[model samples]
Target: MLHRSGSGGPAVVFLPGAGLVGLDYLNMHNRVAELTTTVLYDRAGTGWSEAAVLPRTAAEVTDELLELLRAADVPGPYLLVGHSLGAAYARHLAQRFPGEVAGLLLLDPFHEDLHARVPQEVRDRLKELESQERPSPTEEQLRFGRSQMAPLFASWPETVRDQLIEHHLRVAWRAGLRESENVYDEVAEELRRAPALPDLPLIVITALGRDATQDQLWSERVLREIHCTTRALHADLASSVPRGEQRILDDAGHGFLHEDRPDAVLQAIADLLHRVEQ
Candidate 1:
């Protein structure tokens, strides 16, 4: 399950966050397609892709993506735009196959170093939250979610938007949770052991605003700690490579940064593409 658009070398690829399918990025994909070849696809077990076990390794995910690209005959060095968990896989791919990648644009990405970067209290609270049993969403909750998300995809074709909304409410959200079950343990360890990423054009976009869901899940103090630490971590990541840089978006939240500020996301992609070209 992949969709390719436009036509040009050094293709742009989008790696969606947990629970988000490639189509979720159609807005940016459409824009990038106008500039260069772009790809939108689902990883195994997510979106329209064939089902696989949840929480696969970074190595497994990276290999799958490489195979997908090869099978599809999309040429690379690719410019990868990854969000949240998808960003983790992008980093892994770049680390393992440096020459095949041109640049990386990470949006509010997850980092293996996150556990070590934050205070112990924050970790404890997060762990506690994770331990609590989560019930399925109630009917009311589903209705509310659909209403809130409908506007975001209002520009999309009606049929596609309706299907996406239903899929997200019924399946995608749960899959995202399952996929991230190993982030702190298995995923973190794999990244820690992986080789350092090669120097390349890289940009990390950090969103500081808190969304309603985030506010509901975390206390103000915890959220503040998260934002501060996340900014610091992103800055450090951006500085790790010769061409790395970080951009901050104070008005957008983590999950919907692309929707909230597509212009910023497009600018970051264009900037990285230019750097890669040079």
Candidate 2:
């Protein structure tokens, strides 16, 4: 459920995106550990953690993380690295306990304002799909998914890579959808009502490349529109704080930015860490 490496204060903690386990970010975790203490952990219902009902509130998720850190005695003023849905929870934690956070590195994050930024037609389409019963991934679909993910894990240790690929193909693939089921509604409202984040170092990495999921869900025109809208959203987030900065990556997709461009993610974290120290 949790793993820690290295040793130092203002420890770096990785919050996995929906559907991803802590080990999914092992590549970056190992790299970060070389610099300072780093942690990788699964939320209550996801990854290797015990099962719980999905779609928990941001407060619930953040509180659970806090309790976990206390039990682990990892110390505070953490440098949080969060991707997608995990980024949302990181924002919640920073706002709720500003002093407990040192800085933040958000990757292709999901913001509360995203719903309003997206086109209405796309929203309607998403809602329609959500209303329908979700079908299980067939054998062909699983095989295709595995093939697509293989390259991302190629550099990882052989044993970890094999287990990760299998877990993702069989169960982790659905975790994101289940965890973010309330993202557009309750989750968004919760964030909107939350307190503002304190001044701190923040870096938002926006990945522009399209993945197979996007290709299957939208036309080329829509995908382009999405890219533009997402860039704008990330820019807005970066500008929200005085020290916040946005970095654009043309070569990586949303789900695998760390794998596709580990250098970029690591550099952002290093920059933020320096700023936090300052």
Candidate 3:
């Protein structure tokens, strides 16, 4: 794993969404660098970490994370921050290693089983991403052909948006789709057995809207594509996890962290940390 360490206090071990590399978490890393120490590492085969020779299960991913911590000598009482697809792995880690995890900050995480319930179009897009047709784009890099993805970055500022697009551009093609699927498969199981975690502080940052600022390019019609309502996923997670709290950022879409309002993301972290410390 390629680990990026920021000096300070309680370490924040960041995991990227879906197939993204550890570099995807640079925004959080830069901000948290001064507040507390943090470590950002690519999942095996994705970033700096070499590819694994065998298929991996959810249990194996969690175990690998534990091993990385030991290998890097990252002391515990850790604050885990995972985004989108990465949230499933975070939940597993907190459950499997209760003594090591201090808190969890889940940013618009995938609801797995809920994912299966998503609209056909969304699911189709996901499938396309998984296909061998082309490599997946980084959260940052949506270029000439990829400009269509620019709408997703609409909520983020200039600098944050640019780096993310560049990061997406730099990822290896094979690593994006193939490895992402493996993680998705593992996430499927995590959904089946969403373990009751420790009493450690847990904060879920939920995305809930198609903000008006979005251009005509964005469809306004209500999306009833997902079989399960977003509300249902929210309820299931709240019930299944221990000491969990949900905070919805009104009018923010799926890419809540990178959109027009980064301060909101920053504030969410600051607040979660404050609650944990208190």
Q: Estimate each model's TM-score.
A: 0.96, 0.96, 0.75
| Candidate 3 segments exceeding 4 Å error | 1-5, 53-55, 119-132, 135-167, 170-174, 182-186, 209-228, 239-242, 256-260
Q: On TM-score, who's better, 2 or 3?
A: 2
Clash pairs, model 3 backbone = 9-37, 119-225, 138-168, 140-164, 140-165, 141-165, 155-259, 155-260, 156-259, 156-260
lDDT of 3 by residue, 207-272 (tens): 766533223222444253331356568666765566677877665765445344457766766666
lDDT of each: 0.91, 0.89, 0.66
The Cα RMSD in angstroms, rounded to one decimal, for candidate 2 relative to the true structure is: 1.3
Q: 1 or 3, which is superior by TM-score?
A: 1
Cα displacement (angstroms), candidate 2, residue 51, comes to: 0.6
Give one digit per residue, the lDDT tens place, for model 2 in 9-119.
689999999888899899899999888999999999898899989989999999999999989999998999999999999988998999889999999999887778777
Candidate 2 residue 273 Cα shift, in angstroms, is: 1.0
**lDDT (0-100) at residue 56 of candidate 1?**
95
Best by lDDT: 1
Of candidate 1, the 10-residue stretch with the lowest lDDT total is 210-219
